[model samples]
Target: MRAVIQRVSHASVTVDNEITGSIGAGLVVLIGIHEDDDEEDAAYIVGKTTNLRIFSDDDGKFDLSALDTSAELLVISQFTLYGDTRRGRRPSFSHAMPPEPASDLFNRTLRLFEQTGLKVQTGRFQTHMEVSIHNDGPVTILIDSADRHRTRRG
Candidate 1:
């Protein structure tokens, strides 16, 4: 599982000209599932997305998290997040999980997010969506479950 978490003042997803999900002053999460993803990956993503300290504090420091701020969430499924583009001009989605299993995992992840007690909204899965995002502080973070165990260089 992978997620692109962006702190946003507002965000909404529209499907077929109808608004499916919307939020205010929270985070917009674009999630993607890999072919080998499982419950552990979903757990990792939910834990990090809700607990990450990307929001600013009263002193203007990055110290508050979605959990601390009571922020809303707008989750969107984006299989393109797993697009492998290194091989040629066209991107390959061979690593993205198929819709059947991916949707199941996505729903489970949403449940996890809701368990945190924050308001969660979601886009229509497997549909064409137009997402409007007002990124707060332009704060964006990328997380990948596959990298959880890797050590970072100092």
Candidate 2:
């Protein structure tokens, strides 16, 4: 599982002119499930999304988290996050999970997110949609489940 988390002032997802989900003062999470991802991957993402100290505190430091500020979430399924373009100009999605199982995993991940008691919203899965994002501080973070065990180097 991979997640691109964006701190946003507001965000919305529209499907065929209808607004499916929206959020304010929170994060927009573009999530992707890899072929080998499993339940632990989902859990890892949910944990990070809720706990990452990306939001500012009263003194203007990066000290607050979604849980601390009661931030809303706009979760969007985005398989393209796994696009592999190392070989050619065209990207390959062979690393992305299949739709059927991926959808199941996506829903399960949503359930896990909801358990945090935050306002959770979602875009229609497996559909063409438009996402409007008002990035706050233009803050973005990338998380990959496979890197959970790797130590960061300075």
Give the TM-score of each candidate: 0.98, 0.98
lDDT at 133 for candidate 1?
98
Error of 2 at 119 (Å): 0.4
Q: List the residue pairs that clash in candidate 1.
A: none
The weakest ten consecutive residues by lDDT in model 1 span 145-154
Q: Taking the tens digit of each residue's C-alpha lDDT, what string does model 1 give over 77-140? A: 9999999999989999999999999999999999999999999999998999999999998999
Instruction: Estimate every model's Cα lDDT from 0 to 1.
Output: 0.95, 0.97
Which consecutive 10 residues in model 2 have the weakest lDDT in total? 144-153
Q: TM-score for candidate 1, please give it.
A: 0.98
Best candidate according to lDDT: 2
Please give, for residues 1-154, the per-residue lDDT of candidate 2 as tens digits.
Answer: 9999999999999999999999989999999999999999999999998999999998999999999999999999999999999998999999999999999999999999999999999999999999999999999999999898899899
